[model samples]
Target: MLRTVATRTRVGAVRVVQRRNASNVAVQNIESRWSTLSTAEQNTIAKQLEEAQKGDWKSLSLDEKKAAYYIAFGAHGPRAPITKPGHASKVVAGVAGVLAASSALFYAIRLGGQEKPHTISKEWEEATNEYLKSQNSNPISGISSEGYKGTGYVVSK
Candidate 1:
């Protein structure tokens, strides 16, 4: 019974090792796919991502983001092969048109939603600016500006 138990433990360890090895292989496959991209292609995609980030891509809808990602990813890929009677090119063109339309729609909607933006009140902005200015100019002397208005006080003798 002891020998049988030992054998079972060894088999279990071997199975664990095999699963780990399989996972490693799968990771390597993905790594190879990423590595297959040329440096120039990666640089282009990186630039696209940078531009998208700077252009407020966070406001994009899910479908718009996906479309942009695909367009950026496919920028350096081989052109789709021409099909009989230009059908393939037409289909590709149709997809591109759809993407273009969606992009325009999303862009308009994003811009439209920004017309009446809620902004900080004048009072709050003035207070914030005064606080920042005081912090910058005087470390020890706080409260550069008085909280209350009115310049002076008078009293009867």
Candidate 2:
């Protein structure tokens, strides 16, 4: 019984090794078929490439090198383009719609809004400066300061 169990165990281990080696064989036409391969097949190819790279790099076949490079830098998965076709046109249209809506809102508000306040006039601002001077408002470096040259409340055109 012991002999039979040991033989069976050895045979099972050998079978597992053979299965692994079979899977790790270089995939034929890897470039043409890589994208269409199932995950398992792709993984097998990756593993094969990894093993090939573990040796002297010069010993790596052209296919193995190409496969490794593709796996690392191919335009697939996260490296693929996020935008679909006509994405730029869609973005431009969205921006144009928003701008048109904003322009419409702005014109509507301007036409319906009240006139500018009386305080916005240059004469009113000059009066404000005089009042500030009289009231000692902002005495330090301001309207009430000595030789103050800064424009004070006079932005109206």
Candidate 3:
């Protein structure tokens, strides 16, 4: 009988404490009407709430964490902006205007004046071939004399 009475008393005390905590006027009042508070008061309340939430969050299980994450970060609407035909036409016109302006600018700056078509003259080709032939004839430096040219080829019996 003593043990039963003690358990009931403890349960009653816990319920009373819970009711007292739940009856916080500030939390209730802020939920219904928040704009009346001054900036400093709002900041103070925010900090207190944040600290309390930090401790409460640590006790959450994995499923609770995932639920919170999905509620906060999951997308719940259309991924792309809905565009009517008129809006889409306007967008296309804007893009076409940009492209036309860019093409005009490129032609004005790069291809406005042309003096004869570009061509590799015979003299220029001959000069380039001469330079390449000279480079090819020059033996590579840093190779030992024994390792030069035909030294690595095996002689067949």
Candidate 4:
């Protein structure tokens, strides 16, 4: 008997709290004033919505339906844009700046680097082929081969 009384008291307390938190705002103009509502007001409206949805769905007002849809899919929370205006242009400019800087650095290194090796010259490569032929290197299919008409390491212009 004591447990039943305690349970009834808790249920009555919960109902009183729910009633206190329920908003008096009419659902008809909720769409227009939703953004201006305070957080507490919004939570009250949400509670009202929960109670309304627990009953007959066909009895809900059109305004309530629209409010529910907007609350679920509105661009005010996670769906909101994180970037400011002109974000794409800013990103493109950043990428271009990085590309230009890298190109400049590459050209600076190339221009200040050591000269090409002497072995890269056509004359040096031809002399190397002759030396290899004299050394009988790969006699079957290389510099010392018979009728080997292929260019042998002479690639410089």
Candidate 5:
């Protein structure tokens, strides 16, 4: 008796899988028929749909209903497509926002620990100035490195 029940359950599962495949095939057939219709036929169907009252919708032929469905949603049915909107953008924006906030919090924490904000070392400043002067052909056009104080973790280290 138990073995018979187990066999029946397995058969039911197989039937469910087969039903799903059949459903998919039926949907594909509907989509293909809708697509193959000429522009004039589509327009005529759309006009019919637009003129159709809510109560009269059920009166429409299967083909006409299928056309209406196509009009409502391009290719896919009523359900949303597998691919979602703003998925990549949402992830990128979320990650970027989190990283930016974390870095800013880290910087603020580091800055809080320092009593007097440290300035750039005199030797490093002089060396940088020398390098800039040597590399720059147009001194007036280049950025001025002087009169700026370097603070936070960089200065502390």
Candidate 6:
């Protein structure tokens, strides 16, 4: 009987200490929420976390990252200025204007009559060749005609 009384006293003292700790507002709030959750809800949350941990969580490719960002952070609607066919005509007109200006400038330059320098005739070439020949000797050595009236064979010593 005495040992049972002593054990009961110790259990009561432990319960008092636990009650004192549970008096904390933060601890009491967490305890109240946890007590309110059903066993099935907690089990479901645990299963979801376990499945997520099993999934791949490495760095993504550029394409995959862009796709995820666009899906999560897309803007409201179409946000650009619309254009029509007349815009193309404007570009064409600008190009044609440039071509016409260039053609006019070229035509004006051609009509201005630029004189080409005179090229020397073959007579000038013949005189120049003759002058060079007089300055430079004919390098032809001893020779004879078909009638045979010239130097003999150059026999070596």
Best by TM-score: 2
Per-residue alpha-carbon lDDT of model 5 for 1-157, expressed as tens digits?
9999999999987875565444334334456666666777656555645554343565555654665576787654455476688788989999999999999999999887856433466556566665665675334544334433433123223
* Model 1 worst lDDT run, 10 consecutive residues: 148-157
- What is the alpha-carbon lDDT for the whole of candidate 4? 0.78
Mark the regions of model 3 whose C-alpha exceeds 4 Å error after superposition: 1-81, 111-119, 137-157
Q: How many clashes would you count in candidate 2?
A: 0
Error of 1 at 49 (Å): 53
- RMSD vs true structure, all candidates: 25.3, 7.2, 12.4, 7.8, 20.2, 22.4
The whole-model C-alpha lDDT of candidate 1 against the native structure comes to 0.53
lDDT of 1 by residue, 43-117 (tens): 654554444445456544454354345545642346433456779798999999999999999999998785543
Per-residue lDDT for 1-157 in model 4, tens only? Answer: 9999999999987875555344323455676677788988788788787777776778666777777777778666578679989999999999999999999999999999999887788899999888998899999998789999988878877
Question: Which residues of candidate 6, in runs, are more than 4 Å off?
Answer: 1-84, 119-157
Where's the lowest-lDDT run of ten residues in candidate 4? 17-26
Residue 95 of model 3 has an lDDT of 100
By descending TM-score, how would the candidates be arranged?
2, 4, 3, 5, 6, 1
- In candidate 6 the C-alpha lDDT for residue 104 amounts to 97
**Per-residue lDDT of 149 in model 6:** 39
Name the better of 4 and 5 by lDDT.
Answer: 4
Whole-model Cα lDDT of every candidate shown, in order: 0.53, 0.79, 0.53, 0.78, 0.59, 0.48
How far in Å is the alpha carbon of 76 misplaced in model 2?
2.4
Measured with C-alpha atoms, the lDDT of residue 93 in candidate 3 is: 96
lDDT of 6 by residue, 70-146 (tens): 32343312422356659989999999999999999999998996764322445554555455445553335323223
Clash counts for the predictions, in order: 0, 0, 0, 0, 0, 0
Angstrom error at residue 153, model 2:
2.9
Residue 38, candidate 2: C-alpha displacement in angstroms: 1.7
On residues 58-135, what C-alpha lDDT tens digit does candidate 3 reach at each position? 644454344334324433224323665599789889999999999999989787677744334555555554564455
